[model samples]
Target: MFPLLEVLKSLAQLSLAQLSLAQLFTATVIIVLSPILTDRIAAVRSILFSNYQDYFFPQLTMIIEESDGFSQNQLYAAARTYVGVLFSVSRKPRHFKCRRAIKGEKLVFDFVGEDFYQKKDIAREDSIIANFEGIKLEWKSRAKINEHNGETVSKYFELSFDKRHEKKVLEYYIPHLLARAEEIRKEERVPRLYSRGGSGLGEWLSINFEHPTTFEKLAMDPTLKRMLKDDLDRFVKRKDWYKKVGRAWKRGYLIYGPPGTGKSTLIAAMANFLKFDIYDVDISSINSDLDLRKILLSTSNGSIMVMEDIDCARLEKGGQQNKASSAKFTLSGLLNVIDGLWSNCGDERIIVFTTNHKDKLDPALFRRGRMDVHVHMSYCTIDGFKLLATNYLKIEDDHQLYRQIEVLLANVEVTPAEIAEELLNSSGSSDDVVLARLVEFFEQKLHVKAKAAELKERLKSADIDVDAEGLVKFLKQKKLENAKEKEVEQLLNSGDTDIDAEGFVKFIKQKKIEDAKAAEAK
Candidate 1:
């Protein structure tokens, strides 16, 4: 005690001017480390008094890489979403970074390296300590340069929690995180349409799908539209029902119609309504059954696989013989891939096939479970015409031409495509002029029908054996002529008669003669 008192007295006698440089530096170090020494003393006291089990409990850790077996690059996205949600609400971090992005003519802000929660020695980097149902968990993010490829970098997240909470984390907490991430992704990103690349390989090419057609905008019978929508709704809700029935959780639709009918339009509408990506499979481009399997396997769940003009794929029973000479895939191979065990691997998938001739398709393709729903897109009905009128001309049901258009629609087989084209052609004209033009077009279809009947009667009287194919060809030719005549009549009726009417008439006569000769040769 006497020696300590003498040392303190000697230190007090020294002033700032009398102190040496080394002594001043040591004093400054002591002053800077005083708080740290105090904290260390408090930590030692806590360790001495606290429960040993609580201080040394085992913590389970999980590391999630940017790429997973199921998704190539989803973990990073999930972590970003998780971190974004935390920073958005808490904003407890000291350091933050910002990124600028343009979204639809608006500038958006994004943040990174923002901490939501932290603890001594336990939480570091972009980490957050969260308590879910009283189970404390810590999430940390890390970035590292790839050892194999120095130029590339990879990222991951580490989740640490008490071992007692492992079950909850595996069963509920992780699933909750994934669901939240998906919700965020859906809100921020536009749906995409994926198609096979042109290289005849199985690679997919993605493009932003911007088709705006919905059920309300499609020109079809209201009853049919409602039925289709109901079918889709029921299918979406039948996931458990499908499992109970021991069937693949998928649906198939067959849309058969003429070229001008709205089969493709309905497909687009269905895609938009369901918010599903479209995988348009070009059957002709596929090289082999192996290639087909690869393509099908590469497609993700919740997508529509479309095969347009399926009848053109030559899917008849014995057509494999003809196909084998040049093609690499067989009819049976396609059928197996479509309905066999491989098809069951995907969930919430839809297969759609469109054709101009349903009768030409094989019976095997129409089996009970293969094509669950068959939609026939026929000629434009009055309801469809009215819908088109409202869409194209904003003419409601109370319009003066509604009655005339209804009456004409009942007798003619004009397609929605033709009607839409007519409406577009007359867009610059007055409402009355447009309606009048549609009336003239309908009248020309009536004229063509009358002429067709008259020709059939003449051919029957002449005892000509007209095959079904020949009759179909003849009718198609007349339909083409009807379209051309409608255009010519529109020009003449629009006060453009001064433009070579005689020469146009002669040209029409010459075309008819050539068509008749061609039909006879066929």
Candidate 2:
């Protein structure tokens, strides 16, 4: 002890440069590591204390985090919502500060307004006691933070219960929470629309979908609309039946129609009706079957996968040979994604394909387990027009021009989009004027149809057998004298007057005779 004290006193009395290089290095490292060692010791002490407490208490903790691997865990969401229900309906806390909330304000239970819950109440991070079948569980909200950055990583709920009730909690309480949370979610559900974005090949971007279309407002045939609604209702409610039959809980719809026949609108209506989010899948964007499978599997249950213009994509044809050399996206791959085992990944899903040319698509795409329902969106009809008028013009069914418009609609093959455009363009006009404009538009269409028919007949009589454009081209060609050609041109351009085919034929013969006479004189 005397020797150590004498050495320390000698070192203290020495000059700055008198110490060796090894001593200086050791001093620097010790100074730098002092705080680190202290923190490590404190952490070890806390962990030891916690371990002893847990051992004595004999409690098991189950953590429900906000996210699982790549997607959100459904149980985590349900627990979050179910916690709100506990706060609302459970016994009042021993110590809670009471305050009045604003009128009509939504509480933690969004579906339960202030008027329903009496007042908005629920404090964050407060522990709640849940009693389930005589077992007591304590739930506390917790958040994890990054140790280095001090930023929040995720929030979670810690459910601590007696270790003896593990079986009951696992078998009964968790399922009850899920079912109750689902009920709460349904009361306040707002469907969303999800589509692939430019970020990545399989990334989905979403937004709230609030399209104001329903079965009642659709221009489709009422009978078909009712049938579709019935079908959807049946599909959603048959989960148990589906399990009994050993089939996946999903439905497919093939909506095929002309360009403007409201196939998209029908999809929107179905989404709104079923409270399902829309997952728009672009086949062209998908490069391979693996990418397609990943995208489809990433989608949640109760979503509509709408792949529009399926016929336009460069997909492999059904039953084709040399599939090994086919494009990256193949019909076989698509079939596996839709109807094969991969399809069983999600439940209560609806797959919709839209195309203007249905016949151009592979027949395998429309088979029974693939596209279960085939909906043909035809041209506008009288019933559809009435629905449109009621929606746009707010007119009754017994308008003065209803009969005329109905007759014209029956004869003409105009789309609902065309009628909607007419109505939208005439928004400032009165109902009569609007109906008149629609009638005039229909009449012009009829006139155009009559002209095309007349031209087709003329070409047929002359043994040309060409289309309308070809017939017009034949008339425009300078085959006769300049004056005769000009006369034919005027007749062809005339819109109000119908082409007199017989008279035109006679004039053609006369022109030939005149040409012969002129040739003889020459």
Candidate 3:
């Protein structure tokens, strides 16, 4: 029994040795052919997954839709974040975003996951998953690829199939996301962008509530920029006719003020702010109201349509009543441009009407729904003066001239144009002298206005009403006619004709001045 047992042990030992040797040989064969196998696998994949370009976009879209809370903001932010990560520690990529590229009639990747989040944090860990039906087959391939330079493995897989996700996020996805986000933001602001009240009949005039000459540099005004940015954002995104929303959002401005204020400037600023073309509709230039309506209808979106000095429009200038004579255009024709049929021609359009004489406009012009807002560019106020000083003179707030300017602003009616002209002519002069000169100029203009007022008062007290001083002399020439007529009437009853020319002339001129004074009183 002992001999048989010993024989069994030796046979078992021999069987174990032979099995170990066979396994070793198999291991040696695999180790030697591993590179070839790997190359074969790569070649096969290059063909099998060659259609990935076709699937890339669809896959990305699906992923985005499936992801929770993947809003436009997050998408836009992600695109930027991915690209920024790629260039941060490197030589700094000149291009900040990733995009699709065309290679031989094929869409190719600019970035993939490995190219972006290749760092040692969540990206290198098991956070990113791989799938087949979920494109799971590509998962192992993708996780196999890592950031160049000793990155940790993507725990979901050893490598990745692609490394160009960064490019995709940056060049294609993020931009659209930002644009959509802006649209959403605009939609939210449509109701409160401006108050809807008070129609304006400024078609006969264009008054810039802000000033015209100063409008050339409107973006420089930080406050104006902020306000305008908000307005424009609402104007553009909410109801642009070009969008699928199928509506043209139009705006109208009524600028009423004393002459030479920045009413025109405000329009220019609005144009600049909105990146719009300017279509100045000169009603006087148009032969008829039909031409004016045609002009308004042709105005494009993102355009500023202006009608300057509307109070003096030839159409409204001739008579108090509306006419369609040579004008061939009626009040109704202009209304079509204001808020009627033609206004819907373009979305994101702004119509601005400026007038120096708001009082002369028709009451129908300023009804409840015509003009969106009426801005009055009144006499230059103290704050406005400082803005002019800083804009035109390059004078800082700390300058002594600013303090003196503040003082003059208290009592002066310096229009922005007047102030602008002074600062421009002598920007290099001492602040004190420049301000003194400015103050003197405004004071002189004021004095001229005062003298004109006094002359008007004298004319009113004399009960004289005339558009020009020539009328006074023209009437004075009739002194003999008045005397002869009066003398003849009196003499007819007494059988005598008497002439009192000298007394008539002296008394008439004095009485004319008194009548002028009465008109002035009214």
Candidate 4:
């Protein structure tokens, strides 16, 4: 009975100790919760998202159901994205919205610096003002869609501020702020449109065509180098002019030549020369005439678009397109894309079209406005060979190979690509051997192509009609007259040449010569 009582007493003591521990735990938990209760937890809520069903990202999301136009959530997201926090006012908007974003930082950016602003902050307190302005962000929104204040309009940013928040959100939170700002702008804004001009030409070219690397080599041509220098100068000065021109203030070049010519390489050179991205568009991949517009509309600016072998795009490329026959795009559709109504989607672009058969293109499509510069990347001419030797071989006028090259260059219509290859082949060898081997290789190719060209010319002339011969004569005369027009323009524009100055000089010279002739006859 005594042992039983002792056991009960020990049991009671153990139970009391357990109760005391439980009470202490409860008190400690309540104390930890006291501070949290005084200050509310962050009001951040997890929101649902589907990229395809979201407004900002169309490519990342895999969409399903009601893909006809867009899902309801997508439309709402798009509308908010377009009406992106209005910018006219100096203060933040009352409502701040970022719930749907898993990567919310991507959507907003702080625009910093003096250049972006139209008005220079020329106040005496410029430093102070700039400091304040730096804190302010210029949010970039895309204009691919229309969403104005409570209405569908092209996208823009709102500038209202939150008066309630005491903390200036930019300073404490953002480090490497400028770079982050750029990222968000890239993500949220409807990217600028680059020209489909050159990219549109890619659909026409074949990857397996002879001399694929020729395109990269040909851009180094001296005339192209000079042009590129001038082009950069113009781009520097006229960057804003690109925006001002109702058109995207871009340049286009149409490179046309026979097969194995360096037309395509010139495009690559232009891209590399400018350090710009390439937008390769295949008209066949586009489903509808409208779809071409969408693709053109979607590309970012500061890019070059290449269309290779444009002649064959219509005739040879029924096989390349993956979509069904009903979705096959048309020639008219492509032509519209080059100089279409909605083509004015972006600014400062370059379009390049390469063709082995310039004659195959429609005269209307190659008109002046559609193509600014029509470059003939013909078989090597004397001028071209001199440039190749000077550029690729680094041969000076006094060099031994220079004379030999002149002789080979005179008789041959060798492509620059062919010259470049031969130069590279023996680049590590003795320069003399490299030159000799190159001349030999080129002489052989020259004979082969020349014979083929001669055969073709014979065939063509055999089929030429009498009327066509007259047309050729007329075209040649017109071509000569057109060549003279530029000279006349330069002479006239230089503030020289009185209207009758040349005529008066010629009249006096003719009178003197006639008198001299008369005296001789006497």
Candidate 5:
């Protein structure tokens, strides 16, 4: 060591040209190894310092991986969204490249609507700083690749914060991120409606669901609407509670209503409110239970599966519906998918059944856990009409015709769709005119209902079984019989023939035959 130090001192004093070949070679070797030796010493020092620092002022890191062996981790997805929103809101340019929204994808424009394509800013691997409630946090994103395949096997985010803030980070910051991410998704996502495509069996086709229905604008009972919203809130927040109770994280709703009522619209409102996709299941197109399972299992989680006009579906096992039994879907299969073991396949799923004739359905379908919520979409009430008036005509305050319309609505049963049509048809006119047209339509409907009631009562007095179509047919037949009797009475009064009671019956029969022949000839 002393000799080396003397050589280094002599080299500092000597000029480069005067150095011997052996000295030059020695200097070259020292120069070559200096950076490597320095790096090694620094690395050892860093390790020791890190150990001491970690032992005293430690940090806690929460790792959220992209996949949890089964599915994508919810926290990982939320972190990605939250980080993107954070950067955008902070108005800061990040070092890593951000994902750009491509054409045909839903674009979320800021208030200024500039740089529209930059909305998607999720990075594959990057680090960002976040400050939450006076605590500084570092978020690191990383990807792990498979060495053999050179393909990314997993991606993760590390949220590192001061160990003292661990509880707050877990209890508050994580939840806040999830809530904010959900809000961002709701704002940016275009609800998609899925249907079975003709291209392949069990394949789904999606289209952007642009229905504007919302709970605020929906024409339903206010109390019921509030209850539905509250129920949804409870359902979404009770994920862990559901697991504790051993219940599938799913819900079933049976919406029964007459035609022209807003069952489908209510479903659209629910989807918009929840930001869930709609899968309209056409049971007629689904041949058997196996086919139904294939279709249902293909649907993603966090979606609504709707079976409209469920009463028309072949649910009953026996009777006339038993023809081609093997080819038809059954109620048991539906129940299994909705509430049985198969329901555990997905989480946060909603099953909706709509039927015009609820009474026609089997009681088993409405068993406690199967169809949990039953919503009867009744005819439009006074409140419903007011909602429609406000929606269609932008009429917030009550008009002079409101009282009359309310009275008519009380006495009659008209669906919201019918009222909407009336209002829509007269929308170009004044509010008064539009409302008056609606009132006139209501009065006409009332008059028809009154006439029908009178006819129905007359038929009952004559001991006739009156149905809607039968009433019209019976009226025409009664008119024809009365005309024949009048003609026979006129012949008797004219003394055209001396006919006894027995002969009268024979003559009437002959007249009936002739009348039938004449009608056929015409």
Candidate 6:
């Protein structure tokens, strides 16, 4: 046992000496390569590996920039969507920021970067690995600086994949990504209306369009409203039918009405119903034919272009020599723009023209296929009045004034705008007060009509040669005076007394005779 112990002690001492020599050799090597040589060795290794990779495993790269010319680049938007989708499904990324969406109920988390090489599987600025259908790709975000500008950070995304997978990436993967991105945008982004700012190409100013009007809120004839809704629905679903029929995928509408009617409101309803953007073009703002063309061509697909007060634009028959004294647009130029070759560029387009004076418009503007539909906005009927009553006062059917209001609306030529204004004013007040005010308005309208008729008969008996325009003006003056009389009578009645009937009749007769003489002299 003693001999065995001596042999074990000798072996332990030899091992201790060898371990000390190895430690000393390692210390010397570390001191030699501590600062600069360590960095040099790493640089040499990286250069060698990079050169080897370039020779053996070549890569294909695609760049998606943030802006193209004056417009936001589509691929950049797609890349954002792509990243968002990855973040939704990925459990690997640890450093992320949550983004509360502006329009939706869900929150989105976006990945951020620090030391890229710390985690091999996590997303970083230099590389983000993604797998699709057994194929792998790397996404990298980079910023390039401009020498002339002071640290201008122009960002872009670079997609790199093996050269062997280039065909699949270009053919199927990229298109799929674009389509998915578009779907996301449509579901999340609020729509905007765009218009040309000046003479530049693709220069657009955007406005958030959030019109609340819809077909159900529009106060019109029920049958006519249903027809319009059906027409619009059919137009939207008939893309293939339009192609088969060899017609442009477009429609035109001409809305004619008196002022204060629901022409503009109906346009809003249509826009909201279709989820389409509205391009409201002021005809007076257009300077020349070229300017008009530029505006028309800049409009995107699936949009409505509206021109209000078409008759006021003074569109005459002759091309450029017509007496369109107030407007710079010529008749031929307008017509060609509406139906010419340039209009064929876009799909799913709608053109709307609104005019208060349909009679004043040129006949050529309303030819066979130019305006596919003609809608007339007339005075509010009993149905329309009920709609307004329900909408404004929340009085569905229990009101005592509905019957009387219905009778008055049938005879009076008041517009929906006017009724809506009155109803809005009467809101939150007692129902009785609203009914009485509406009744008084109707009574005044009836009195004006009756007095105008009486004046016309008297003028005919007197053999006056007054034209229609002159007679209308004279009648308006009489109506104003009658309104004053009604106000005076109301004041008297409020005091528990009435005006002297005989005295009032005498005063009215004297005033009418004086106005008749004045009008005759004129």
Best by lDDT: 2
List model 1 lDDT by residue over 231-305, tens digit each: 998887899999999999888999999999999899999988777778888777877777767767666666788
Better of 2 and 3 by lDDT: 2
lDDT of 4 by residue, 247-363 (tens): 556667788887666665666556555545566666445556676656655544555777667666543132233333323566566656667655565665677788888887667
Which consecutive 10 residues in model 3 have the weakest lDDT in total?
A: 189-198
Candidate 5 stretches greater than 4 Å from native: 1-187, 317-321, 324-327, 472-522
Lowest lDDT 10-residue stretch of candidate 1: 112-121
Candidate 3 ranges beyond 4 A from true positions: 1-232, 240-248, 314-327, 401-404, 449-522
Candidate lDDT values, in order? 0.73, 0.79, 0.53, 0.51, 0.75, 0.74
Worst 10 residues of 4 by lDDT: 123-132
lDDT of 2: 0.79
Error of 6 at 24 (Å): 34
Which residues of candidate 6, in runs, are more than 4 Å off? 1-164, 185-189, 198-202, 321-326, 456-522
Off by over 4 Å in 4: 1-13, 16-236, 239-248, 315-327, 382-397, 446-522
Higher-lDDT candidate among 3 and 6? 6
- Give the clashing pairs for model 6: none
Candidate 2 displacement at residue 194 in angstroms: 1.6
Model 6's TM-score against the true structure: 0.66
Best of the two (4, 5) by TM-score: 5
Model 1 misplacement above 4 A:
1-173, 185-189, 318-321, 324-327, 466-522
Q: What TM-score would every model get versus the actual structure?
A: 0.63, 0.68, 0.46, 0.48, 0.59, 0.66
- Winner on lDDT (4 vs 6): 6
Which order, best to worst by TM-score? 2, 6, 1, 5, 4, 3
User: Which lDDT tens digits does candidate 6 get at residues 224-249?
Assistant: 99999999999989999999998888
| Structure candidate 5, residue pairs in collision | none
Candidate 1: residue 89 lDDT (0-100): 52
Clashes of each: 0, 0, 72, 30, 0, 0
